[model samples]
Target: MQEISYKQKVLKEAKRQGIISCWFFLANFAASFLIAVYKAFTQPHTLKQLQNLELIDSVITNLTTLAATIYIWLAIKKLADIYDTDVYEIFIKAVIAVVLAIFLLLALGLEGITPGAVKAVSYVLVGIGIYFFILWFKLNFALAKITNNKLFKTYVFFAIISAVVGGAIKTLAMFGFFEGGVYMLAAALSIAILYVLPTAFYLYAWTMIKEE
Candidate 1:
């Protein structure tokens, strides 16, 4: 039996991880699009029912993201071990930030929480979200340099555009700038294009990595 070099090991893991990531993203994106379209087309009699559906969708998306984050961290850790790079540290921090954000969001649902406290939590969550994006961009940039894969760079570009557009839509929705149906439809389109593009690029980028 012959021992493969670390590059081969990393590529094998990446291919496996890429398939998993691709499936997760596809599931998440499809679910989100379907729910948004349903909400846009049909009106539920009760607000609670609508809210419940949205909550379920959000939970599924967040769970998928968490799982993907862990897988990405593990893959990068292996690469870092082989290359003696520090990008895995960013993954560790990103994972921690995401978990903390999720926990804080859940805490916001507790009864008897003051409005001020809620506002503060929201601010913290926003900050954490921004930091996570920065870390994510840095991690991808580092991987792009390490692997010389333009797909990673392409992901970064589309990710930034997605973030900006999604953020704008959310902000406008908060201000009641659009009707419910309009907002949901717009959000669905945003998720379809913005979210799917980056994930697709990421998956393809993993496939592009090969040993020299």
Candidate 2:
């Protein structure tokens, strides 16, 4: 009975991850498409004009964080439950991570918000988000190492690439590397990276859990 119950939980988590993965992809695609369209219609969009529509960017961030968090947690749960490892602390971390990620996103969404100024406790939130982001990445990479699965490793490889390209483009854009039509290209690249990360992570996890 206990064994069967364990299997059921694993299966449940696997199915949940699958559903969430699809949603993440759709939400990401919609957000990116909307942003690109918005940029196209307003070629000469200024800081204010761009920032005004930042609300859309904020929504995208929220969706990204939410989907990413749940997807990570589902993976953690599957690994812990199946191997009878203690999942209590990791569950708590997952909650904290998800909340912080979403909160940072809300900061991004508001009309006046900027990376430099999130108003109150801004540094605190950003600090937490950065730490959690690194920690989460490490944990995931550790999982990939343990699984030694080709798919998981591939996901890891591409995730690194996505982060590099995304981060580089953002930095360049800050220095005006992306402007005019070039900015639109950057927008497309950003959306593509966003879509790919969760797709890779979720598919790898889903495959692992399903075969478990």
Q: What are the per-residue Cα lDDT tens digits for candidate 2 across 28-82? A: 6677687768778868988987887787777786777678667756756676665
Candidate No. with top lDDT: 1
Q: List ranges where model 1 is wrong by over 4 Å.
A: 1-6, 42-59, 166-185
Scored against the true structure, residue 45 in model 1 reaches a CA lDDT of 42
Taking the tens digit of each residue's C-alpha lDDT, what string does model 1 give over 177-200? Answer: 877568766666667557787677
Error of 2 at 34 (Å): 2.4
Candidate with best TM-score: 1
Q: What's the lDDT for residue 192 in model 2?
A: 68
Return the TM-score for candidate 2, rounded to 2 decimals.
0.61
Clashes of each: 0, 0
